[model samples]
Target chain A: MKTFGGPVLFLDRDDINTDEIIPARYLTEITKEDLKPYILEDLKLPGFDPKGETTKAARVIVTRANFGCGSSREHAPWVFEVNGITAVIAESFARIFRQNMFNCGMTAIELKKDVIDALFSYQDCPDTCITLDLVGQTLTVQGGGREESFAFEIAPFDKALVLAGGWVDYADKKY
Target chain B: MGKTTAEKIFASHLVDEPFPGAKVLRLDVVMCHEITTPIAIADLVARGKDRVFDPTKIKAVIDHVTPSKDSKTATQAKILRDWARRQGVRDFFDVGANGVCHALFPEKGFIRPGYTIIMGDSHTCTHGAFGAFAAGVGTTDLEVGILKGVCAFREPKTIRINLNGTLPRGVYAKDVILYVIGQLGVNGATDRVLEFRGPVVDAMSMESRMTLTNMAIEAGGTSGICMPDQVTVDYLWPFIKDQFASKEAAVAEFRSWWSDDDASYDKVYDFDLSELEPLVTFGYKPDQVKTVTEMAGTPVDQVYLGSCTNGRLEDLRVAASMLKGRTLAPTVRGILSPATPKVFQDALKEGLIDVFMEAGFCVTNPTCGACLGMSTGVLAEGEVCAATTNRNFQGRMGKGGMVHLLSPASSIAAAIEGKIADPRKYLPE
Candidate 1:
């Protein structure tokens, strides 16, 4: 598994629904690159991708429990993946996104509150780093050597999907 | 070393059950709404899955974004209508015919006991009122469900919401649910199936019981069900095939899901109906609520009185009766959307339409329209409105529009006051 590099930006909120991730009007996409521009439209950020500027670089998302907690619109992951979000670490994830991301080859790390808060506090220091070891089920912040291990219990079938770089690859390998 | 009937169902369907005590498991049925279907269908088409697993099993309704107010949205609705038809979804409950898909499905008998049902809409758990494992899923799952006829899940630790006593007169079933959401918050019941039991639940009508279980997903739940009893049998017998037709058999089937006297739950929540004031959510979240008595001084921009959650005929009757002899409060828009054309016709036959029109409420055709911001009744500014629909997320009703979740009774009460008001104040106490 790829260790998500770089400091984390934490979003603390509840019921972060899919419509806000990427609104419904842009449901049709020609490619994953098409969805990067609108990730977190509801966040009211400036430079709000007027022409669908899909994410061009990797950004790790750190969130609260039940992150991705609303409608099972796959846009949540599509936007995240296209936007260069390499992985997500949350206390809990909506069942659909957790499954969809794995199928899409986006990694998710279930972290405890301390790690989440630690990552958020370091947001000002962009150079901070966090390392994830899939084999060890461990996640650690490089600063001050603070680390927390979370057991990300992935089913063998799902792990294969992740290892194969998504459901399509896994399905091709199997059938 | 024992299992609940739900447990048995999960085990039987397990492609491979996860380790012990794990909430995740495999699924059998999945459901979706227009909001999610447009994308799910696109995915399925991309994959070249021409036919859905079983058209009859898939129920797609145009409750959201129908009766389009503008020409642009009207064209969009037309597109969705043709797509659903082309997709071979047999049960396309359209706007006039479509009540809330969740309410109309069970009312029309699509949901059966001991079966698995899924919907793209989060409120899909509304099917669990019939003792089915109904839960809402997103579009990705919808695409998979349409092709594969199954989804994955983790068996949730069940919660027994024991109703301790009979409800006092005038305390309708919506109060039971608002009380739960109030206590549980939006995520309190996450990934858990809530089984309603106790003396109070026994006293509720099947329609009323549905309203309670219907909002299960509001709490991020797997499903909320009530133990099927005689009421379950009688309500469902007419819909089942004669081979599975006996009410006694249906009741027997449902009773098997009931917890033994000593059954355990991950958590227990209890409510006293005698104390429940008519409830309404004050803000954009279902859990952001207050009693109707708490509404006296709140502000509002509009009132929406329909959705799958509270768009039934019974819901309208109560609202119309309250507005029967009274004029509506000024400036607060009250949009009365029936769940289906039949419901609309029923209201017309019963003069509920006349009452609504006279009371200044704009009656619309059945469609899950405005609640989803698809079209019609879009609001402006930081306006706060009360609605009977599920979910009050930002922009759910329209750009910058805020929705406060309430029951049909509460919406009407707030409508008459032009702010939030206790239904008890307007309706007979």
Candidate 2:
């Protein structure tokens, strides 16, 4: 099994689409690495800057419902992967994007709406960090001298895909 | 137990039950376009597994940024072209022959009832209009579909949306779907198949049904399907006549894919279209919709009439009826891109192209260009547009621009008025 966690970046918005995740203009780039600098380049959130220090420092993203809601571009997850962001925790995710994340060997965790509401309280803390325990199916959040843990679930096959480090590896073993 | 249409299709295509709720099913068609397919091609090549499961089952198109806007896009097209040639795929459509993938593939009669199709483009759901189970996937699933002829999925539940009542005058399929999405919200049908039924759907043409199913992804639906009928048989007769003994036989074969009367659904919603008005999306999300009356006089800088959603010949005829002799507002720019070369030719023959150009609209080739801001009709900063496309997401047409999603009739109304307006005024009483 594999685990993930790190500095958390909070984007308090619903329906953050793939276009905002990585603009379509850059999709022609030849390699995954070509997408790194353009992560969240088109996002219009109130205070989040694509070039800001928080964007560069974060390794996980916590957002409201329906993250990655538009288009079926796998480049959205590839951008997150190239940026070293291993997990995205949201109240819900657009179906194809959630699948794309797991296909890339990354994690897309869904928590309850109220739990997402409670997590947002830690966004302003400079030291806010999160960790996932895949074996235990638990998520722990720590920041500002406070800590909380929550349980989550993944489908048996999706868990296996993540454990095998994404679809390519899983297909290599099975097919 | 009675099975929903989606369940029936899935059960028929089942290759393996990988887990309790997941099934791996064989694919009937795997569609590809330059934008997304090149990446899958590159990945498969890098793995030393550069091969296709069946050359005949693959349909490739160069629609996204056709005529290659830049060297990078040119390279993407070249990669796809080389891969298709190497694999002996015969259904490839290049620039002049290319239209938008979602529009071109179906125009060629490639989709059929009871079929299972997958594509890397989100609008692949558009093919579900023929009673097929079609859904979009990412690069990995697409690669798997290409190489193994199969892809896996979680068992899907059905949401039966019964659109009843006579459609009000001036309201089209685009307006109905926009209204449905508004009621369902953006994530209303997430992970579920939307089975469109009742009198309203039964009366729609194949072009209109395609428009309805094309926006399935906007509601987070896996696919949107309609039960196959004589209308479907007639639409496909030109291409499928040889495969069946008669049109009646073709219709009978397709009826087997329909959901039983006693089929259980996750949920059911009924909509009455008699009072429906021309609707348009106000915000970035597809679900942020309002009737044109609610948004009248909201100024726009541009008006776009095209996309897989509303660029069909029927759509062009509707727009032309309104633009027959009227000129666009002085400050507003108008663009019309027919979805396919066939659509373009038909429009020209019908004199619809002259009506549009005489009314000051610029007619461009069929590319999904301006819809995704790749080229053709990109918007300037802070500019607003009324478009007949599936999406109105932020910066969807250009950076810092706004798009109001509407039907072709309503879009033309906005072009003439230079703001959001109702199309009913232009319709003959």
Candidate 3:
């Protein structure tokens, strides 16, 4: 399984819908490359810009409840992946949005609401990092010489797919 | 233990006894539209599956960006058309050929109870109004359906929403759902299915039930289902043919699909609709709903009446009845779109189209247009619209614009007054 870690960029907001992730106005663009630049531009979401230094520096996004709500556009996850966000830790996710993240080979770690609240308390802490170990099914948050590990859940099928680099690869091998 | 409606349907489709996590299970129907099908077709070809397992079981429709709003979307639609034709898909609805997939498929008698339906659009839960198990999936999941006639699913717990008491005048299924979503919050039903039960649900018409189920995703529900009843049989029988020639015969065969009396549920919510009023949403999230009386006189620049939600015949009738022999306020621009071609035709035949036209409302063909800011009637800067479509998120309808979601009556009343107003005043006594 793939293992990765990166500095955390926390968005304490709840119900960050797909429309704000990648607004439908940009969906008409044919390619994900073309749509990438417009990701979350409309919302002006904190720390989410393809060129912003803070967004470029962070690899994980932490948000409270309903990280990917609203429309089931695959482009939402594609944009996040394009912007170098490999993992999103949230209190919960709308099912279709979570499935799209899995399809895009990104990790969506769901921690309890209070756990997310605890993570948000470190929002202004510089150089905070979160590490994800897929095989271990855990996310480790570290800042100021303190580290905490939070357990997460992923079905066996999803684990295999992520290990195989998403469903296209998984299906190619299985079939 | 007795199974909930979601469990009952999933259990029937399992090749073996079900467990908790993902498993490849049978699919009765797989549907997609222009926006999602291109990705699925590309992924299918990349996986060495040049054709589908069962083209007859798949339905492709071009409804989201219909009539080719631009060269970009037009190219995407062309790609879907070519791929669907090459695969010999039996139920492909090209641009202008039908309306939205969610409304068109079921209206044409494709959806039925005790079956599992999968689609690439989040609103696919709209079909669950027929007592079917339908859930939205991503494009990769759609690829699974095309290549293998099955998709993986992890069973979800069921939440029972027991709606009781009679609906008050001017209150509709839209109001009921809006109220439910407001109480539940957007994440209340996350990772779960919602089974709507009790007398209020049973009394709803088929179209009203569809409206109820269509917004299930707004509250993060995997799907929402109401048990099949006489209303379901009556609305679907004319467009369908089976051994059942009469309503009694159809009900006898389909009624067994309902959840058992002793069914277990993970959570239960009780709502009384007796005092419900016309509802409207003030902010971005659908859960930001309130009674129209509380929000009356809120100013608006435009009004849109359509979507998979609130674009059915019943919704149109409500709007038309209110706008008949009246003109929209000169400052307001309104667009009234039916959900399906059949609905548009029926509205036209019933003179509802003329009523809207006389009120200076732009009556357009069925599409998900403008609801997602895709095409037609897009909002301009700093403008606000009272719309009947689902979702009022910032810029959902256009850039720098606001969307306030309301029932058709509320939207129509807003258009007539150029501001949000109580719809009850316009309802006939």
Identify the candidate with maximal lDDT. Answer: 2
Candidates ranked by DockQ, best first? 2, 3, 1
Report the lDDT tens digits of candidate 3 across residue range B269-330: 99988988899998889999887889988999999999999888999998888888899999
User: What share of the reference contacts is kept in model 2?
Assistant: 0.74
Candidate 1 segments exceeding 4 Å error: A1-7, A23-35, A44-58, A129-131, A140-158, A164-175, B18-29, B67-88, B94-96, B244-246
How does chain A of every candidate compare to the true chain A by TM-score? 0.77, 0.96, 0.89
Top-TM-score candidate index: 2
Query: Candidate 3 regions off by >4 Å?
Result: A1-3, A44-51, A143-149, A171-175, B15-19
In angstroms, how far off is A74's CA in candidate 3?
A: 1.4
Cα error of candidate 3 at position B13, Å: 1.0
Query: Candidate 1's interface RMSD, please?
Result: 4.0
Residue B174 in model 2: shift from native, Å?
0.5
lDDT of 3 at B73: 90
Residue pairs in clash, model 3: none
Report the lDDT of model 2 for residue B7: 95
| Per-prediction TM-score | 0.88, 0.98, 0.96
TM-score for chain B in model 3: 0.97
Comparison by lDDT, 1 against 3, better one: 3
Model 3, C-alpha of A149: deviation from truth (Å): 4.1
Overall lDDT per candidate, in order of appearance: 0.69, 0.92, 0.84
Model 2: per-residue lDDT, tens digit, B1-429? 898889999999998876788788899999999988888898899999999999999999999898899899999999999999999999999989999988999999999999999999899889999999999999889998999998888877999999999998899999999999999999998999989999999999999999999998899999999999999999999999999999999999999999999999999999999999899999989999999999999999999999999999999999999889899999899999999999999999999999999999999999999999888899988999999998888898999999999999999999999999989898755
Instruction: Specify the poorest-scoring 10-residue window by lDDT in model 2 chain B.
Output: B15-24
lDDT accuracy of residue B218 in candidate 3: 91
